[model samples]
Target: MTFKSLLGGAALSFALALPVLAEENPAIEQRQGQFKLYVHNFGVMGGMAQGRMEYDADMAQTAADNLFHLTRHDQSRLWPEGTDSMSVDGTRASPAIWDDLDDFVTKFAALQDAAEGLQAVAGDGLDAMRAGFGPVGQACQACHESYRDEAS
Candidate 1:
């Protein structure tokens, strides 16, 4: 029932659902790959924040670091125009992503800020991690709400 164990179970279940091969469209494949990493790392932080897992500084730091690393990467190539769900069969990306590029960029900026804050506090202690978790989760929610379709 500990947080780490619970997250481990969830992660295993999710791993079983990951795509086995790259999509024919590189954009969909790349975005899905990015999302898989995001889901895995975010799940770790979320499990600790929700008290489903024990707070381990090392584990928290590692998870935060993974998220932080993602924010630093250039993901422009993953979201080309015409790659949305409306046009593609394998993706759930909203067309609004390209239509509202500025907002998406802003949300990503917010994610970057949150990731930096989480990275700074992740290894400090539970209180620090708790304090930093909200902004990152919120940033993710903002982007998902605007650009991602709910899973079927």
Candidate 2:
């Protein structure tokens, strides 16, 4: 195969591998892994916004883009039934997540929207990023308050 064909095959393989569903216990771990990625990227933006980290437009844009991608990622398998904190150890997902999945998904969609907004403005300037920051944080807080168990 040509070099470009090889690279295309690899990319296609990766894309096809992304959607396999996990079993219940493994689903918890999968979702946790996904959340860790979200936290890591979001923390970069948060640090910049709070002045805890120096603002770099390229880094901010990359982080915002990663967060946007993550927020839009399909994680239905990662949230399989019986994966909540009450059923699974080492998780902070409340059973309420399953009880009212539609509302939970609505809240997630709101976060996705907020992340898109951040992605659009994150590299514009500190002022622009700061303006976009609050909505993302609020969306996260709203979902966590309703769906996630408090950290011990």
Instruction: Give the number of the best model, judged by lDDT.
Output: 1
Candidate 1: Cα lDDT at 122: 92
Q: How many steric clashes does model 1 contain?
A: 3
Query: lDDT score of model 1?
Result: 0.87
Tens-digit lDDT track of model 1 for 72-145: 88999988877777666678888898998999999999999999999999989889998998899999899999
- Each prediction's whole-model lDDT (CA): 0.87, 0.86
- Candidate 2 per-residue lDDT, tens place, 34-69, comes to 889989988998999999999989998898999999
Candidate 2, which segments miss by more than 4 Å at Cα?
1-24
For candidate 1, give the lDDT of residue 82.
70
lDDT at position 132, candidate 1: 91
How far out, in Å, is residue 115 in model 1? 0.5
